[model samples]
Target: MEKFEALIGEMEEYGRSNHVPIINEKGMPVLLEMVRQKKPHRVLEIGTAIGYSALLIANNSADDVEIDTLELSQERADIARAYIDRSAYKDRIRIHIGDAGENILKLSGKYDFVFIDAAKGQYPDYFRKVYPLLTENAMVLADNVLFRGYVRGAAECPRRFKTIVKRLREYISLVSENNEFETVIREDGDGLAVSQRLPKENNR
Candidate 1:
């Protein structure tokens, strides 16, 4: 237990020094709570930045849970692989490299839990692509949905961020207003949205 704690501490420091965007510490509690509450057997992670959140999910998940994580950069994937290799859940967490938008399609099985923390502007695309792969009642958690409060802000968004803010609003609408999902935007950290897909019968 102590060794695992030490490993997590090392990863946190590494993320800080390397400028890798990881799950906000403030939001980890809710993330882990969902993992524990769901106890999902199959989990899908859209982004595996340095494998920080992946490790957290693996550590808190059921013993036989399998995690398929997508990463766009081979360099970051390699770094994540090295870190995962040092952990006990190394074998269970498979790193899939390349565009997550495509990789999400290549997935073979259904997932009870999906975590999205990749490109801020592509949240809606990721949600659309992954919807078919989720089991009924699956929990889909997205980090950075609020994107520094621009998505819901009343003031004008900066020109550089207008596109992303628009996309994020679309993503929020996709889940929040969709009858198939029960969505909530958590204000902790940058922000996180936990949306659960209702049962198939409830969808149509």
Candidate 2:
């Protein structure tokens, strides 16, 4: 436990110095709690930023859990791979290097838990692509849905980020309004949307 804590501290320092986006402090507890409650056997992560969140998920999940993580940047993927290789959960975590949108489609098998922390503008597309791959009662957690509080009210958002903010709102709306999902938007750490797919029988 001490070793794991030290590693997490090092990763957090690296994220700060390198300006890499990582899960915030508030989001960490939420993520860990979800992993504890769900105990998902299969987990999918859209963005593996230096493998920080991937490690978190792996550490909190059951021993036999399999994690598939995607990173668009080869440089980042290499760094993440190195980190994963040093961790205790190395054998279970697989890092895929490619465009997430294309890679998500190529992925086979269903996932019991999914974490989305990739491109803000493509959240809707990612959700749609992953929907069919979710197992019954699967949980989908999207990070940064409220991009720096811009998605809530775009009037104060910068022109360049308006598109992303608009798309995020749309993504949240789609999840919230979907009949098969029970969605909750949490204000912790840039905002998180936790959505659970209802079973077929329950939906009717």
Residue lDDT tens for model 1, 85-107: 99898899999999999998888
| Residue pairs with backbone atoms closer than 3 Å in model 1 (clashes) | none
lDDT of each: 0.91, 0.91
lDDT of 2 by residue, 45-155 (tens): 999989999999998988899999999999999999888888888899999999999999999999999999999999999999998899989999999998898888535
lDDT of the structure predicted as candidate 2: 0.91
Candidate 2: regions farther than 4 A off: none
lDDT of 2 at 25: 90
